[model samples]
Target: MKKTYDVIIIGSGGAGMIAAITARKQGKKVLLLEKLPTLGAKLKATGGGKCNLTNTLSSEDFMKSFGKNGRFMSTAINMLNKDDLREFFLSIGVQTDTKDGFRIFPVTHNSSTIIKALEAELNRLEVEILCDTKVERLLFDGESITGVQTQNEKFNSSNVIVATGGLGFPMLGANGDGYEFAKELGHKVTDLYPAMLPIYVKETWVANCTADTIAKAIIRVDLKKAKKLKAVGDLIFTSKGLRGPVILDFSREITPLLEQYEQVPLLINMVKGKNEDEVLQHIKKQTALNPDANVVEIVSTLLPTSVSKELCLIVGAILDKKFKDQSGQVRNDLVKIIVNTPFTVTESIGFKKAMITRGGVTLKEIDPNTMQSKLIKGLYFCGEVMDLDGPCGGYNLQWSFSSGNLAGHLL
Candidate 1:
């Protein structure tokens, strides 16, 4: 005889675990399936293993961060905002702290702490968890979910939540299984793109600046159509190109453009938003104070020695000469480079290095209020498997927990 559950959740990532816990808390016979032998493999890698659980932003501001489709997260966030999530963690004997005063993480600063606590709570709640179980397909009876078929057996459930996350970290068991299931059920899966990853640029000079991390750098797309796309954070030059907080956030916009254009030009303000005039004035002040200072030393006041030298080379300024001794055109060009260093991005590192997947099942077929599928009764969706994605800083994880909570309610 096939065992039955009131609610069956596929995948045991954050969303799947949370959904199982929520359903079991309601006294429903809940079962969680995971293809991986261990649960929360990707969650363990979140925030580079610190596990940023959520943030302190208000629901309105939080929704705005996800952009236009962010409105779809209103009900979910309203039900399980940051405060609620913290309280829930506290209930399970896990402490959290926000040292940065915005991003939240377990006090231990280890993702294993959060995962272990959740696993303990799930065990305490008597939720059935089957690791190493691969779900082949959702059993849909045309208009409703009947159950799910695994490689070895069939589990019967009227309500099933497909919390299988998107393909981001393939090494961590991400395979786009949720998107496949959604497509099989007649849901529209949006074009998937690898996001939150480092990009390789056409300029090899960036290799020279790889040792220094520019703080508060501003990066913006140079294209007229994408003039509004910009991000501000710490920027790191890499052997291949650029990475760090700013590039990871802005990569979401660039990857989609990469699908259309051969190369994407970027204007990076490495001098912390200083304009040409401001940089020139700073150089002038430095030169007046130290007349012997060469172009490298003068520019090094605003940038690292390596970066300063690289910029001087780009503008063809003599390194050993005083800033005033440089040709007028060279001086102007140097200031422009100081304000906006140009890089032509040729390629992204792709899914292997991406932190998240940009597109998944379209939101049009899913109810944001309950996370239930509008096309099929008793079918629900949650987590990164959905079309919506947000920038770093706990937005994606918060969305997973909130949507899972809403989906588990079976409302």
Candidate 2:
């Protein structure tokens, strides 16, 4: 005889595990399926294994970070915000710390600690788990979920929650299975893009500045339509191009635009938001104090020695000449470059290098309140499978837990 579960949760990532736990707690028989031999493969690699679980942002501010589509998370976040997530972890015998007073992580500072706790909780609740099981397709009638078909066997359940996540980090078991399931069931899957990854730029000069980390750098898209798209954080120059916190966050916005344009032009404020006038004023002040300082020396006061030299070279400024000896046009151009350096983003590192994916199942097809499919009964979606994605810190993980919690209710 085939046994029937009250609910079947696909993929054992953070969302799937939390959904299984939540359903089992409701006294419903639950089944968690994972494609890999081990569960939480991607979760185990979050924050480079440090596991940023959640952040301290309030609900309103937190939602705003995700941009316009953020409102889709209202119900889920309300159900289990950062505070609730912390309490839930505490109850599960895992202590979390916000070392920076914002982003939360297990006190042990290991992603294994989080994965082990989640695994233990699922075990304690007696939720059936099946690793090395890849769901081939969802089994459903015309209007409702009947079960799921896996590679080796068929699972029986009226309710199914798809938490298969997005197609980022394929080596970590991300294969876009959830999007396929949603599409197979007549749901719309938006165009997908690789996000939160490093980018390659056209200018080879960035290679010369690889050794320096520019603090408080602001990167903005030079496109007229995307004039408001910008990010602020520490920036790093990679051998190929740009990376670090600023580029990672800004990549999400740029990836979509990349599909439309061959190369995206960028204006990088390397001097910590200093305008041309401000940079010129600083240079004039420095020149007044030391009348004999060369152009590189005067510019180095505002930026690293290497970056200053590069900017000076870009403007054709005589590196060994005093600031007053340089042509007025050369001086102005150097100041402009110092304030707003330009670069062209040629390409991204792609999904294999991306930390998360942009775009998933469109939000309108699923109800945020329950994470259940609006077009199909007994079907739910959670985690990166949905359209919502946020910047670094703890936004994405918290959304996974919250949406999973909402979907687990089986309401």
Q: Which candidate ranks first by lDDT, i.e. highest?
A: 1
Q: For every candidate structure, what is the RMSD over all alpha carbons to the true structure, in angstroms?
A: 1.0, 1.1
- lDDT values of the candidates? 0.93, 0.92
Model 2, C-alpha of 344: deviation from truth (Å) = 0.6
Clashing pairs in 1: none
In model 2, state the lDDT of residue 187: 98
lDDT of 2 by residue, 1-411 (tens): 666899999988889999999999999999999989999999998988999999999999999999999999999999999999999999999999998999999999899998999999999989999999899999999988999999888889999999998999999999898999999999999999998999999988889999999999999999999999989999999888999988989999999888899899999998888898888889999999999999999988998998889888999999999988999999888878887899999999999988889999999989888999999999999999989899988889999999999999987
Measured with C-alpha atoms, the lDDT of residue 376 in candidate 1 is: 92
Estimated TM-score for each candidate: 0.98, 0.98
